[model samples]
Target chain A: MDLEDTLLMMPGPVPVAPRVLRAMSKPMINHRGAEFSAMYDDCCEILADVFQTKNDIFIISGSGSAGMEAAVGCTVGKDDVVVTLENGKFGERFKKIADRYGKVNPLENEWGYSFDLAEVEKKLEEGAKAVTLVHNETSAGIQNPAKEIGKLAKKHDALFIMDGVTTLGGDDVKVDEWGVDIAIVGSQKCLAAPPGLSMVSVSERAFEAMDEKGELPYYLDLKAYKKSGDKSQTPYTPAVPLFFGLQEALHIVKEEGMPARINRHATCAEAVRAAVAAMGIEMLPQLDEFSQYSNTVSAMKAPEGVTGNDIKKDMLARGITIAGGQDRLSGKIFRIGSMGNVQPKDIMLTIQELEVVLKKRGVISGLGAGVEAASEVLDSLL
Target chain B: MDLEDTLLMMPGPVPVAPRVLRAMSKPMINHRGAEFSAMYDDCCEILADVFQTKNDIFIISGSGSAGMEAAVGCTVGKDDVVVTLENGKFGERFKKIADRYGKVNPLENEWGYSFDLAEVEKKLEEGAKAVTLVHNETSAGIQNPAKEIGKLAKKHDALFIMDGVTTLGGDDVKVDEWGVDIAIVGSQKCLAAPPGLSMVSVSERAFEAMDEKGELPYYLDLKAYKKSGDKSQTPYTPAVPLFFGLQEALHIVKEEGMPARINRHATCAEAVRAAVAAMGIEMLPQLDEFSQYSNTVSAMKAPEGVTGNDIKKDMLARGITIAGGQDRLSGKIFRIGSMGNVQPKDIMLTIQELEVVLKKRGVISGLGAGVEAASEVLDSLL
Candidate 1:
């Protein structure tokens, strides 16, 4: 199969812009050279702007998970008490990382639910030094209240760390204003760059904490990374070409103003959610007040006699790639992403494809109903 | 400056093959898709063949350092004893990583010297559970006695780990025969792919150790990665485009037989070394027996009155890029790479450019001397 021609409707590894792809095709350059340093400087500056932080930002040549590890390792040392808000898979991953190094107080919530700030505040009152949360839970299509959680963390004098993997470019993440001590972003999610590079912004409080406790390991040590970034270089050999692509991707993000980018994702989410609702499917997270527009990769109830895997397999046959729920929801829900470079037409086509796939699998679906519903929503927005 | 036109003569982040660049330009795909799984499976099989092992191979969406951390985290636990042969910057990095989770017995050597296998044996005999060494130390232009050290580790019952970052595709590495329980490779160096993905192979013995002590942290945990790779996927989102490029690059490596590829690198190395010698310059590592012909890079001494930085800057002015020595030898030596898809013409042009740069910087007698020397060597062989 020609994967290049197939449309990626998944949450991440989203469709990259042609310009970004062309930019990445440029030949590699010396990472320490003047030209590359200029590129690196520009990337750091623009990434800080995107993250809305004046604190030092370091680019790690790893995935979002690596960024999480770096965040956990650099901030909380061995035997530290960490309170993790686990509303979804990504949040639980933070607890897993914390469990590796120290004691973890997992503030568990339902899979399709988000954390209540009051509950988190209660956990923080129990003497936790750090609190971790995810901005967007890709697994469950839920967006947590990070700003509220940050406030709670501040009230308790705990370090607030956020995994902004799927939310950075498509959402507003004011690290300083939100009192986030460490904010991590992956290149592939909303930035429309291929995944490899991860950016983290560390607050002065976190830096001081790292200085106080010097037990952190070498590679993930935030102090060493910060020192190296002062020279526009990483402590190790970075993924140079990916850095180039990121520079171009960040440029595109800036060109499309941040508010407009977020609105675009919101529009896409609204169109998808409206169509799914019109098709008589229930949204997993029923709390509209807590619903975020960063793009809802909504989980729908499978039709009679049809499984989520059945719909996913049929969608794949029709040249569309959607995601199935992970962990407990794996066989129950289907996920379609409307973030990054995805256009209204892409969404419309996806809905149409979904209708066909559902019908082909002998599930109950009206012919052309999904497309009509999505188009009506798009027309009203346009 | 047009980075695309400038030849990459540096040790890594080298110019990728046109085919590899084109492959990377392919559109992003869902990491969980069957097509992606197929590509991942193919790449892993080719990587295992290249390492000459029957062990399971994994490709992480990160740089060489990420692979190194995974290797260290997987093999050694907290308070485990690890002996590292520190000869250059990368070896020091190994010591740093070892110090993170375990006690390290560092057998330190000079910056430009190869490790003494007898000394490594002595250290391992002093109760180290594992021995870490760089197969080819790029910073010093030295290839350690991996075969001898592997035998020593077997006699001492220590897990043998080698960093094959710069040597995997350009040189012969028999992982099983060399008693290397774990071997790591990066995409940019000799694999001819862009820098992002790192590959690691684990022997059955390493797997057994991991099975016994399965408490590694997430992200760098081998057990998590191994479980995911059983279905041909990573535990987290991967850099999809880079994997596409790596799949193509691995196919090219297999198309050209491993021995033939190693011989090609040897031929290029001999020609580069001959040209440098004729210019009355010394190589960093003087012992010929310890020399490795992974033409990926060759370290040479700076001429009298001309620092390695001076030569590198001059080359950059002429749109060529040769790397200066890293860490302690930063201004003392330079390195030239002729591996990957670099052809004879590229070597000849680099030689011509080097002669001009050297003469312009007042380091050599004649402008055409180095080119003539290189051409004579090529004529003798070809």
Candidate 2:
């Protein structure tokens, strides 16, 4: 049960970098003190670099979903028209959030499918004030066409917001280039930190939207948070130690170089997909053109007569923690993540273990078949 | 900069218990996994015992303020009247949160003072749907009469919500006996865990109100959370590691026994207060009849020539971190907290350090004077 004894292979709450863990264990400081302010300023500055924006960056002391709530709460008003592209669980969640505040125009897609830019553009042309999409859908292991969607939002004068919970550090999320007005990321995903702090970068347009909205419930109000950040503090006491951990994680990301890191993730993801395909299991989204290269995770349909839960349970007994499909696809699809400091060797080990578990659970697959395919993929990349 | 090398003396993010730290450092598990569900269920059960309630208990993966928002969001609808008792900074925050949703009727009191029940009763009599108050106003080191306020809310047939951020584990909060409908506690405060998760126990009556008002924004909607808890999960992914840590911290609390823990806090608070009185520095809330005995923090005025910030800076330089006055009382008062595994030895060490620092800053009339007074107080307790 101890963290030191286990290797987490789940999409998030992945193994934190040792440096980040050490940073989190540092002495607690007063959030309003000058020392903490200095750290806070440096943290935000580096975060802006990671986010690729000049927009204000604020850290909410909560999970990724809290960041989503803050984004929707700050932008959408009682009667606002919000278009949310739903490709997976998290995207559907954005629609639910929009439903809470305003009218939701869902650009719905099947689970394990990517959004069609043309259809989304049609929805935007029909009059939506804002559009929300998930950059990477961890649940279905699909990455939507965020850049195209962002361009479409601009075409119709709609604010573009994206949930980058599982893709921020591992994928190419150039907020400025993508024309994303708001982008949200969490610490526990590709950041390789624990699951507590959520980072949000907001552009000028989102700030103006907040300005036009007079009353927001205090805790989630972007304006109040922005004003407080001017003094390098949160309006309320924050999760101070979590930021210490994040500072170290961001440092690691910077030192590694973002593009190289993203490429590494892409490589790892390709290896995972190659192994899964070798097992004769189909990738959830069959179109190679629509495949996302984020190293975080790969989704595959549970082969006929095999449920995702059965694979998950079998993997668990072998100390591997793969995720089952979420929402509508639960029990039908299986997901394997290789992001967050996971190297090729780790992925190979996982594939080896997975093959063993599958065979032990009565699958007649050859043990080395998956590993050989994954090795070929790795060799090709090298 | 290393955690083990430093002492955390601020009220919250106070030094986490070693056991809790180890627990938090454990490997991450799927939030919906059987192992995590077991931990979650145990934590909730223990939390209910700590709050003295059989009602449903849930944890939000955010800071205490997020819990405050949840309480306010779930119980009140648009245009509902919420009466807040404002004596210090936290009380004012309650007013701000209530104002975000609907009408907020604030029964204002001077800073560094306790609530006047007579005034609260008057406001409640005027037809409010809910009343909010901070059980422990850490800013001013004043604890309000939660039991009395709970009576008023019940009399008016209104939901009674109390913020026990700094009070819950250190003080006696009899939720059932006090008729408190909604009570919130944070992990970092008296619970001796890091700041990430917040625990809330809702009464059947509060659920009734939420059921009647279905307009709550998604994340903060307690009804959605309540429904999810039935499955031993959250509507959104949770901070699983923090929740694991909380389970460990709550276990320690249960093993120690609630009354014993409360008495320990009381004893520590009394020793600190007695020493402060002997130093000839005035306590902020001077009325003996209105004083509360929560063990977490003690608030007092700065001596004639010494500003609170100066005293705090001096303490910080000596490796102690007593807080300066907040809000309106800034630079006029200081606070010292004694809760969560802090002992008399810590109190004595702090007093000795404070005496030296005070004399060095020329703020005290005599050298070793404050230490001697604190020693005498400790001797009397023994």
Tens digits of lDDT, candidate 1, A296-327: 35666666677778888888888888888888
Model 1 regions more than 4 Å off: A1-3, A288-296, A359-365, A368-372, B1-3, B288-295, B367-369, B380-382
**Model 1, DockQ value?**
0.70
RMSD of 2: 2.2
Over 4 Å off in model 2, which ranges? Answer: A1-4, A286-295, A360-364, A380-382, B1-6, B286-294, B361-363, B380-382
Give the DockQ (C-alpha) for candidate 2.
Answer: 0.57
User: Proportion of native contacts in model 2?
Assistant: 0.56
Candidate 1 local lDDT, residue A347: 94
Q: What 10-residue stretch in candidate 1 chain A is worst by lDDT?
A: A285-294
Error of 2 at B198 (Å): 1.5
Q: What does candidate 1's lDDT look like per residue over B99-180, in tens digits?
A: 8878988999887676666677789878987899888888887777788888999999999989999899888888989989
